[model samples]
Target chain A: MASSKDVIHSKLWQEESEPGDPFTATACYCSGYDVYGELLHKASYVDYLYLLFRRERPLPHVARALEILTIALGNPGPRDPSVHAAMSAGVGGSPAAAALMAALAAGAGSSGGAREVLLAMEVWTRCGCDLNAWQTAIASPPVATRQLVWPDIDHFPGFSPYARDVSIPVRQTLEALADCLPDGCARWLLDHRQAIENLVGLSLAMPGVAAAALIDMGITPEAGEMLTLLLRLPGAAAHALEQGEMGFRRFPFFSLDISNDPGPAMPKEGTAR
Target chain B: MNERPPLETFEGSLNTTMGGCFPGERAVFRGHDLHAELSDSDWIDLYVFGITGRRHTPSQLKVLHAIWVNTSYPDPRLWNNRVAALAGSARSTGILGISAALATSEAAIYGRQIDIAIADFLVRARRAIESGRPLSEVVGEELRTRRSIGGYGRPVAKSAADERNAVVLAIAKKEDLVGGGYLKLAFEIEEFLLSGRWRMRMNYAAIAAALALDIGFSPREYYLYLLPAFLAGMPPCFIEASTRPEQATFPLRCSSLIYEGPARRAW
Candidate 1:
């Protein structure tokens, strides 16, 4: 066990210069393979992604689960804020990087995005793997009444506002994917599905399912958000490119009344400047 | 068995040390009671203190606030504001539209990052001048090596006679913040640059960055501090554009585009 002082001294302050060059290498090794030389041509994109994050190739079921989740959350339609932002930037003739950056920034808030997913993971960790405790905590009052509040627990990060039964598909997907995994958070989440539903009064959000699967695969919560963001980048880029081709088009809702008539200017209110 | 290290090994938290909950009863901020401090201190002071872990005098606070207020251009034609306007034109959500504009605000040439680079250069140049190097020599050396000074040129205007610059400088003068080393170095460099054939003039970025350095912020801190300088201007543009018809902002047709490629061919 480390003491407080020991931990303080050991706190990580990484120096990049001391290490041998990690960049500019001839070939990249990921998930126990020469990715540049071989895996790039042979492996599936999802498999490569799994390898990059986990540092080990995923099981068939795990890879399938990831594939499905990526597909499901890939677009979220142009109506989604991040995609809309990208499209908007593209419409304004911004570069691809600007569009993508705008999308990424838009996705960083407390809404159904990466930050919220990370918050959900934090809550899961704080609950000590106890589903009942997690549910009770989520159902608790706000910070003023409860004396303490977890970062985004009041909003319940992993629950969707659009639909209550969203968790059903997520639960089914996780169950199908759990065959190859060690019995841990992923299994726990699957096992306590009904109970979670009863307590939250809604199905688990896709982010919650993603958080569990990622945690079970030895991926950290922060890494989970990053991976999600990476998967969504292509979709953002595609939307942006489409918008660019559309020649500065606007969405339907942009048509609104622009009136200039103010109810008879109040006869020169004070002394005229 | 291995011997343990000493217990007095803890150093300090690096950046912020302002406020944290004390578990049960109350919160503490910068070694003062949060409630007590809130009642007595201005909110801007509290905000500055929160980021910097240091308090500012009333004059300093006024000048800092003025920096932000002066740069709030309501015109939607500006680059960042154009982004917000376009997002609104596309009927994007409020969060999406605003964040898109903020992200565009981080561009290399005319964004927050350039302010930091310019400030860093000014600080280094000031130190060099202090060590007996001529200001002209330093400016000449910098221009020769880097080709372009980060904060000197304005893309939109030919001259440096901007109302915004005048207003910000006036505030700085009023608050007695015009005599700092960085500010002096910035003016000297500007004078040298203006004498050259290019006739480059100091833009608002240079002035803002110099003032930021004069106020005792490090180059990195100045960059972060100036990140929200144009934030207030973005929302109005967004709101106004959103209220207009879709794609009303600079809409173009396919026929209007210059097609320089080979005559139309089938796939």
Candidate 2:
């Protein structure tokens, strides 16, 4: 065995010692920008978050666009599976951290979740400025090369099939986000929103809008996945706490039918015909 | 092809082959009564049943159980276990600590990622070999593509030094579970690797992945089934740390940190 177990810390961040104390941090820097000395007062939380991922500050309009999207995604509402999962954890009196985790796991799904945003952003990379490519990709999404951690999506990712029409929030976020970046992917999406919606016969949901906006801001699909997971967390956390207070009696529950009957013990070891 | 359903189909309420709970009454797991039918079943066997929808014979279950038992190195120094130990030291909850540790279970190096990669490689190598390609050529193709295979070499220890492989193999042999195609292929590839300039020994992952495939596990099934492979050892680390003073597990001074970041600078 090696005598020492030590590592050179991440180059992305570090802190300065106080004048007399070596243990405590006097200042901190992220990607070489003094977080407390410079960006703390000047940078918005959105800008700081952007720098953490992109390693650079966003332009003014881009920062605004991100903030707008962040607000819209902050709460996915009680009906959304992510928030509902957190609520379930809360009502069950699980550890505080479990609520957030439940939210993340449920929110990372391929349907109207962070995974959808990641997938949609990938589509943006391949089909930039091409409506025809979008149509083909949506009509028949390509298969994953092999088994993946998450199950394969059944419908076009990023769009909301649950919503029969383009919902109010989706339209509002799309239009406002487009104005922030007046000539990019978000703008293109907003301009041709109706046509894009028509192709799927379903509404372009928040993940779809978020995907286009994040891609327009030059964020990668992977980063978009993380961002969506994070931005949507506030709603899950808040709802979890509220549901915890309200208790399980008030919590929404579901019933399932494997069949009309309680099924026979799973065809015991080779008993199945 | 990945067949996707229409939007209309997804809009309907849930349709599941797997069973669910009825609040106060019964709960079903993969169509079996969780409390009644599976109450007496070994957890590992039921876990496999849950994933594969098939129950293993006694010998097969023994081999499968042995795989997990042998790999459960409770030593907190291991990457995934360290997270649990640290969480306990920090006075965190068991659920949070174990979940966090399990989150790190599929890390890029020395985790489920490698198992999945190696399993896929073995499956592909098997296909290529059955289609008349030599084992050596298939391995060479893998080397050319991925540069280094996951299950072949132990980066931390030489092949001769690693202890788990022999023990697990011994258990499998006793159970008569060692003669499967993938296991034979694993040993054959190890021999090929040893004779060549790359003198890599078959590690636990190679053995386990092969055994899983031999036991009728698809690559996906192996991955899912082994999600909590390290779960047994995590709680002990957590419990051990909880007995000590807060933040006492492997406590280090501030000076111990090796910060190679930028030097102090003003705003």
Candidate 3:
């Protein structure tokens, strides 16, 4: 049992009591911008993010790759759990913050979100960056029959309903991004696209490409999910706001049977436990 | 093979005071063999023991369970429950819907954070009173720093009589757990706060915090322990809503929205 004093002082990061204002700094400004005091005016948001995470400016190709990945996964449509949760919250007349919170929670799951990408990244690492080894392992006897044996690990993060037939522009953008980057995970993914598709029986999803790009850029698996969350936030906000504005409470197309008993019965007043 | 990180550089140890499970063999809970030694134990008892690394008497467990049961409202109007219902209405998967609801349930105003704050306050206040500071002065100092105490106020309603609070208090009294210093001080603070025009009453968060603090659970432990309390009733809401016509739970119309923005313009 830690005493109150011990608990309070044991925090890992304690801000200095007399630290100067955060907005205006003498040395390095926001996200390591110290050159000529003019980094903010010139750098793009992705460049700033790159500096913030990696503590250095991104290569042009790296910046472009991040931009492409971010745009590719910007909107997963209303069917995605996060977007649907946001719209549902909006339809219920919840405030914007509440809707956003619901969306974030939905997006934090192991399926159809960043957690899936994290799992895929873990599998990639576990396979020692060898696609052949991964394919062999998944294709072997006992594991092959299970299909989804590993806990919390999605064997294919990029397999989506639309994977079989990706839009031409999206494919072209991915191909273009692949051409600009070094021969790392992203390039490997592009190079072995058909093989991966044949093995998984689905085309690569944008999230899989994003995960490879993130790993190539030196982002860890844990941080990858957070980056994915940040990327999806704007799209979530948009869906929530749109639902709050233009949508009705009842989604027009969906249909199901309403339950008579919605929840557990509350203990009657004055009843003994 | 990938090179493993140096073991000497690790910040922590391999041993955990918490429980662990072996795939098909056994589970060790709080240093005890769960299967052999504690198989007959109550689920809530095992849960508390696993979390706090301390065992509670049956009376204490009863009171704790009662606190959770009392706060588990089945009504979907609550914030977390609303999230669950909305998830169902949107036809999302069970895990996504429930996780979303649980995540939103950690809100500052009406959720686990408030309970954590309350527990932290009670622990500090108890220590202050033990150190010779008067209860009123300590409470007044706290109020001076923050406008309203976390556990004391009921924002939506004005009544002091809450059914859940009454049930929790009754259980505490029956279990002989009501005489603790923190509980006493909580009552004193409630009296002091209600002395003037302020209509704030001691709600479930305050009572639960005081009880938990008295039972030797720290503020952080109290927060983690109480995670499943409100969670128990949330799933049924999601389950029920999923069975209903999609987007039917608390359905609204576009006309219901009050737009205060500029006149519609082309993009």
Please name the candidate that would achieve the greatest lDDT relative to the true structure. Answer: 2
Quote the positional error of residue B110 for candidate 2 in Å.
Answer: 2.8
TM-score of only chain B in every candidate structure: 0.84, 0.93, 0.89
User: What is the Cα-based lDDT of residue A239 in candidate 3?
Assistant: 81
Write down the DockQ of candidate 1.
Answer: 0.02
Q: Model 2 reaches what TM-score against the true structure?
A: 0.86
Per-candidate TM-score against the hidden true structure: 0.49, 0.86, 0.52
Instruction: List the lowest-lDDT window of 10 residues for candidate 3 chain A.
Output: A141-150
lDDT of 3: 0.69
Which of the two candidates, 2 or 3, achieves a greater lDDT against the reference?
Answer: 2
Tens-digit lDDT string for candidate 3 (A136-177): 745641221111112333345655433345556546655866
Candidate 2 structure quality by residue, lDDT tens digits, A1-273: 122565336556766675566557776678778998888778899998888878777899999999999999999999888999999999999988899999999998888889889988988898886999989887778455332455767667668856777889998999999999898888998888889878876778888899899998889999999999999999999999999999999775654557533454444576652
Model 2 global lDDT (CA atoms, 0 to 1): 0.83
Worst 10 residues of 2 chain A by lDDT: A1-10
Please provide, for model 2 over B1-267, each residue's C-alpha lDDT reduced to its tens digit, 9 standing for 90 to 100: 224465576554576777788666668888777887789998889888988999999998898888888888777878889899999999999879988899888776676877888898888899999999999999988888678778888867866645888888898899898889999898899999999998888888899999989999998889888888898999998889888898878764344455555555443
Lowest summed lDDT across 10 adjacent residues in model 1 chain B is found at B258-267
lDDT of 1 by residue, A1-273 (tens): 222232211111111121244222443344236555677677798887876676566777777767876775677568678888888888888867678887887776546677667766766666746976886777662231110111333456666544547556666666755654547676787778678766766567767776776776667777888877776677788988888888674543242121321212223467342
lDDT of 1 by residue, B1-267 (tens): 013233243223323344455344455576556764555888667767766777888898898899889888877888888888988898886666777787678766777767766887888888898899998888888788778787788767766565677888999999998998777777777788899876887877788888878888887677667767788999999999899998777553222232232332211
Could you tell me which residue pairs clash in candidate 1? A158-A205, A254-B246
Point out the higher-scoring one by TM-score: 2 or 3: 2
* Native A-B contacts reproduced, model 2: 0.27
